[model samples]
Target: MGRAWILCKKMFSLTLVFNALLTIACCVGILAGFYWYYSGWNPFAPYLVNGNLLWFAIAAAAINIFPSALLGRKLHTGRFLFHHYFYGFLVMASAVIYVVLFTSVPLTTIFLVNNTSPEVNVGRFFLLGGLTLLLDDLPDVSKRIESGLNHIKAGANRMRKVIVAAQVVTGAFSLYIFAAVCAAMLTIPEWVTPANLILVFTVLITGVTAFIFVKRKAWNNLIVNGEENSH
Candidate 1:
């Protein structure tokens, strides 16, 4: 399982995510950059309103994509509570921004519907809850689900990217393993004799040769054969 999960981008960096100043900087940069890039915005919502399939896909992705990334990472433990809450706050903030700035719905109508507790904005709560669920992937529940989805059924048409992954893993894993072994040889003086070093280099060269051969074989089909990748 560990070997299989080597490909996952856990995003567990504390410096990148947990730092208060860095987080604020990142948020400001993203929002300001996007606003500057597009002077005017049009929420031509469901961009292709004429096409139900496209609209449905867009809506589905908007609601599900974040959850999918979280699910793939499976980051739902006590340690990740900060991420959970932070992302939750982001969702609510986004909803609030939309409501206050762009929503055509009246504030009174949005709030008056809540009878349980007038102080508790039901409208905001509904949107907040939705955003929280959509973003809360609860990754630990299905830690390996991402890898499982990656193992797509192979076919001539679908195998293009998969083949590249296989080839790279084959070559890269070999080099990575050999590099560690070479590093290990230095643990103790005179532990790795000159004879052993020579043998290791010989094996390393052999492995690299195989990697190159497979790479060229791939190029033969990808470039020499003049076949463009599938969209």
Candidate 2:
């Protein structure tokens, strides 16, 4: 049993690491897409170049996305629903702030550096990403849950717990990023542009990676219910 538990832990760690890598890859891909799609064609490109405030927001986004992706991936299916929801909400909130600041009316009142912060852009980013994430994951969540029983059948409760815990921690980190962004928006000067967008992407990615690494390191030592008895 001890041997089995150890094996479970090992597998769990590997899955999480792999998932993290995948999330990073996804962010990079998205960044490239953003650049390619908007660089020369978008009317807002010059605004970003001139305002220069977008850098701060980009920095924040880069720092936050990594963990948000992981949290979405790691959230346990059953017992930690609230945690998952919180993280999802946080992600949505951050996305909304960024999108609104960039796309619509002048964000000067808030970030003080944004170009046109149109009211129509209000919460647009959040609405887009939040809905997409929710829609994308809803089906997967159900599939994962339905299949989870097989894991239990194989005496893989330990495995399940690890995955679930990873999810919870990921969610927590999302909340943290959300808080950090809110704080930054309140305190820091606002700027907008492609460069700033890149910065935000980087910041979000870095933030997520840092949180996952920290949380996973701690989670490794944690013993689920069957740790002692089963082992």
lDDT of each: 0.36, 0.40
Error of 1 at 227 (Å): 41
TM-score of each: 0.23, 0.27
lDDT of 2 at 171: 43
Tens digits of per-residue lDDT for model 1, 1-231: 663343343332111121212222222322333355444522122221221122222222222233223332333233334444456556666666666665555544443221223233434454435344433433322436423333421232255555444444544543443454465565544537543353245334433533553555532332212212111
Q: How far is candidate 1 from the true structure (C-alpha RMSD, Å)?
A: 21.5
Model 2 residue 190 CA deviation in Å: 11
Stretches of candidate 1 above 4 Å error? 1-49, 59-67, 75-83, 90-134, 137-231
